[model samples]
Target: MRKPTSEKNQSEIAYEVLRQKLLNREFAPGARIRYGPLGDEIGMSATPVREAIGRLASEGLIELVPQLGAVVKRPTLRDTTELYEMREAIEPYAAAKASQLISARQLKSLQSTIDTMKKLHDAMTAGKKQGQDIAVRFDKSDLKFHQTIMNAVNNQRMLTVIGDFHLLTEIIGAARHSYSIEVLEMTIADHTAIFEGLTSRDPEMTRKAMTVHIQNSRELTLSRLQDECPQ
Candidate 1:
């Protein structure tokens, strides 16, 4: 029993390490994830590595093929469109629900993330730091802000679905978008509007703000994908 538990722990560790690699685009979209080499690289054995790969496949982060093994999932433009569609459907509702129930503590935490992002945006604009330098940090705060709202609902299933969408978008967008200053500014503005709505505790306002933000994100992401992968 202890040995099995140990293996499970190791597999979980492998899953997280590989998932972060995927999120970081260390494994590019469509890149083969060779099990043996990956295990060796992570200082783990094949069994645990295989288990971890299976978990990622279940999460739609990778695809398992018969002869080719596991490969990082490469979301197409259609996939991106569908993903944003789902987000648009769910997130605004989440924002509306969250506006009614979010605690002052959560609101404060969200505000802190926004403040950090604002500083990053200001720094980028003033040429104190490169946009890319702060891009990943800004993205982290962005994730936290949304996750905080979703978590407030106390619905595990909704959180899981929305979390998956967030992960997919981050992975795919990192593979494609440049995260330019203009993009960051647009994102900051959208987040500010959403934050204001949340602070106002106005459900309708929050919903509308969230809807607009998701719509802008869809357009920006789809445009970037089309530009880079023009056929």
Candidate 2:
């Protein structure tokens, strides 16, 4: 029992470590994930690393190619559009429900995430460059802000589906490199509006705010992708 538990723990560690690397764009889209070297870097054995890779593959974060091992999946424009569409369908409803059901404590936590994001956005604007770590944190806080709302919905399935879409968005966003400061500021404003709606416990306002935010995100993502590869 102890040995199996230890191996499971090791695998979980490897999974989280590798997941963070992928999320941070350390392993860029379509980059091959070599188990041996990655295991070495993460100070784990190949077995656990392989286990971790399999888990990520199951999550659609990595794809296993025949005779090519595993590579980070590169999200296409269609993929982005579909994901945003799903978010548009589901998240506004979730946000509206959250506005009705979220507790004061949860609202405080959500506000904290927004505050952190605002500081990060301000720092990036001042520095004229968003460092990789700051950018990663900003992404996390952004996710947390939304996750907080979804979690408030208390539906496991909704959380799972939305979480998957969020992960895919992160992967695609990483491939686009860092977001512009203007985009970050716009995100902050959108979040503020959402927060205000939640605070007022106005379901319609919350729903509308979430809708606009997701739509803006979809447009921004499409614009960036087009800019990156103009035909």
Candidate 3:
């Protein structure tokens, strides 16, 4: 399906808007989300709001808490482990296959996004943004990097099944402990390696690079959590 220029109804617009905010950390994990209140927040009514929340809930972004209505989901460490495990199995394959099948046009599109990432990184460095906020700015690029790899592979089944994991990883990135400046720099390095692998279109190297990327990020995330919760 093609991206739409305009929403056909209020619910469609509402879902996209809310989903973006959720993904971007406008709504934090365990955030209490009231349907009627959300409608007011988004300048809509309960009906459309309910529909939007339902759509997100289906995607594991929010969960119905019985007595508490819909709450933004907080993933466990196990959730992160399981999620990265799946990405390990699928994303590397996606990257490998994409390397084999990625057309010149697809590579061009990816390079374009890579250029955007360069600009985004420059803006961050110029502004000297600090702390958790850095992740907020670059997390979109992180999502783009992964999504572009999937697009390059051009596999529909990979897109459909791995797509959820793509979003889940973003949530993990956003909702997990904020990365230190060191972690952020390390992330950029890992992404560069993944891009190089894809550009070379080497299946084995690409899979190894992506798996290493996931493991490093996972360890960094868990390390941050350990410092915070001490569990």
Clashing pairs in 1: none
For residues 1-231, could you state the per-residue lDDT of candidate 1 as single tens digits? 354557888899899899777666577778899888988998879899999999999988899987999998877888889899999999999999998889999999998988998888788878888655576677788889999999888889999899889889887777653467788888888988988988899999999999999999999888888855433
Superior by TM-score: candidate 1 or candidate 3: 1
The digit string of per-residue lDDT tens for model 2 on 121-186 reads 778878955567677888899888888999899999999899888888888888667767788888
Q: Candidate 2 vs. truth: CA RMSD? A: 2.3
Q: Model 3 over residues 1-231: C-alpha lDDT tens digits?
A: 986434237788788888788667887777888878777887777787788888889988789898998888777777777787888888877887777877777677666666665665665667766646666667776777777788776677788678778667667666563555566667777877877777897888888888888888778776655543322
- Reference-based TM-score of each model: 0.90, 0.90, 0.83
Write down the worst ten-residue block by lDDT for model 2. 222-231
Off by over 4 Å in 1: 1-5, 65-67, 229-231
lDDT of each: 0.85, 0.87, 0.74
